[model samples]
Target: MKKFIATLLAFGLVATLGACGAKESETTNPPAATGETGATDTTETTELQTIKVAATPVPHAEILNACVDMMAEKGYKLEVTEYSDYIIPNTAVEDGEEDANFFQHTPYLDQFNTDNGTHLVSVAKIHYEPMGIYPGKSASIEEVPDGGTVAVPNDVTNEARALQLLAAQGLIEIDPEAGLNATPKDITSNPKNLEFTELEAAMLPNTVEEFDLNVINSNFAMAAGLNPATDALASEGADSEGAQTYANVLVVKEGNEDNEAVKALIECLTSDETRAFIEETYGGAVVPVF
Candidate 1:
């Protein structure tokens, strides 16, 4: 009987040892269940990089800011710096302080690049701000009396566009040789003998009451609560050369055209939400080119 009790106690001791071994194994190498390591939950795995850009306040920055969520999905952050003047934004991008800029059109960019010797190039044409003729004194092109003064943007390219739109309405005629660069000097026929007043583009809206008619850019017009589609006496054709060639663009230093971040921003800007925002917010003042 004593021998039998000894064997039973030995078996109990072995069983206890086995249980301890199993507990150690479990503690040392625990099994991964749902939502454990090596799973597809990206909560702690993926992080996004940030991309900075410079833009004008009126629409460029606002448009870009609208794409934040879209860009985030692609693992990028869009930081937009609003610039008041035209020169600083491009300069900032050229100096690598900004990844890109979206304020100027292709023609303006081309001219700026030529003038400043900057190596900037347009990657995508996003939208165009239509040039419109607004009424202050004259309700229509025909109503303007002879020798009445018309206010136009004093810039070379903008003035040309204004003159072209006026010519399209048959209110005046310009020299065919002048092309997009048409100026007051290019006006060959002026039956009304109306005088043209040149003013800074940004100030055109504020000084609208000072002139019989104001040829204003879409941005300034919008700020002045004038909708180009509904309020303008006349506007540039939607398919005009100015609309296409001067379409606002995403610009970067020439060599960075193929940059991954810049390409992603282009994709985001041309996205559905961005297009919808431009159409709805600008109310046809800004047309998407993509």
Candidate 2:
């Protein structure tokens, strides 16, 4: 009887050891991935798409900077390259060095493509910086003496725009057929007999003091401490044909019109926030065309 009881006790001890070992094994090595662990492991991460854009310094870069946060929210990152000259932006886009540019108008783009044989297109019309006639030696158009020297941009498109602005104010009459491509030779009427001196668009600001009146592009005018809204002797009105025709545009390489990243950029630029920012910041010097 004593031996039987001892045997029974030994058996009970072995069973307890086995149960503890099993419990430890369960703790150390979890069961193969069950549905519980595997089902909850579905965290997803989205990668942001990056787009590079070239722009002018003042309003274009400022406007693009404002949209950075808004774009990031949409899974896109905007990288802006500021260019002071108008030529490089388009060339950069054409060469694929930049994804898009924001410093030119449709007419200028058309002329550039024609001139350089680059394939570029406008993605969206952003703003209009009205060409303005600013005072140099003369305070007003009527005050200018006959045969007064007026400075204009040498670039084909902008010189044409400058002439058009003068024509709009009755200072001159451009050949109706010449239209946006008009040159000084296209002038059919010049009651003031104003002599046009064509210079680099960027040089017009510094040379303004030398001429009787200067037809300055709004961007250059603003850069030279002149305000198109107030300092300009005369400016293109928001409703003027020039304003509608020369609205500065967002441009891209021809085939990138439907690019997803470019589309996101356009959406941010044309957003209500961007419109309000332009209206408030530039006060009328830069008009939002939507």
Candidate 3:
């Protein structure tokens, strides 16, 4: 009986050793980490390489925030920094703190580049805020009393645009050649003898009630509940020189024009979804490029 028990025990040990050998052979070529199945771990690590952008509060940042998902598909992240002031965004992009910025027109961007020696360039045209000529106490352009005040933005470039808009309306005539540089002094014909009140752009809406007529920027008009398409007595044509020159642009430092992340952002701005958002949300005050 003892001999038979020893024989069974030895056979059991041999079987156990065979089973362990087979298990080791199966795992000899372990599965490779193709960086695919571990998608969660890959995403958690790659999500850290986000591209930062600076934008204004109105539509720039708002529009960019809507594109986060589209960027993620390309393994990129977008971070938008809202800036209320116009000057800082450009500066931020130039300093490399921001990868790109939105909120200025081609003219403004060109001027900023020229004045500051920053090589910022427009990557895409996003939208344009139409300039509107709103009615004031004078009621009508035909009845403007002599020396009646006409309010315009005081900033250099905008003041010029206001004058051109007035020129387009036949309220005044400017030297056709003066272009965006045309100042109040560039007016060659003013049949109404309308006195011009130059105030900060933001103040134009409030000053309208006090002036004969006010040429308010679309931003301020929207804030004051004035719709360019509905409330303005006159407005710039969609294809006017103003539209081409002052179309709000997405900007990046000169060499970054070819950046893949920036290209994605440009694609986002020019997308159909962004176009619909601009049209539906801003009425005619903001027109989409695409």
lDDT, each prediction: 0.86, 0.89, 0.83
- Candidate 3 — which pairs collide? none
User: Cα RMSD (Å) per model?
Assistant: 4.6, 6.4, 5.0
| lDDT, model 3, position 137 | 91
Model 3 lDDT tens row, 92-185: 9999999999888888788778888998998888889888889999777676787878999887788889999888878889988888988889
Please report, as a residue range, the 10-residue window in candidate 1 with the lowest summed lDDT: 36-45
Pairs with steric clashes in candidate 1: none
| The best candidate in terms of lDDT | 2
Over 1-290, each residue of candidate 2 has an lDDT whose tens digit, in order, gives 99999999999999999999999997786566447744433347788888999987877888899999999999988999988888999999999999999988898899999999999999899999989898888878888998899999998888888898899888899899998889999999988788989998878889877999998888877776788889888888778777889999999999999999988999999999999999998998998888
Q: Estimate each model's TM-score.
A: 0.83, 0.83, 0.80
Writing each residue's lDDT as its tens digit, candidate 1 over 66-119 gives 999888889898888987667888999899999899888877788788888999
Off by over 4 Å in 3: 1-45, 138-143, 223-225
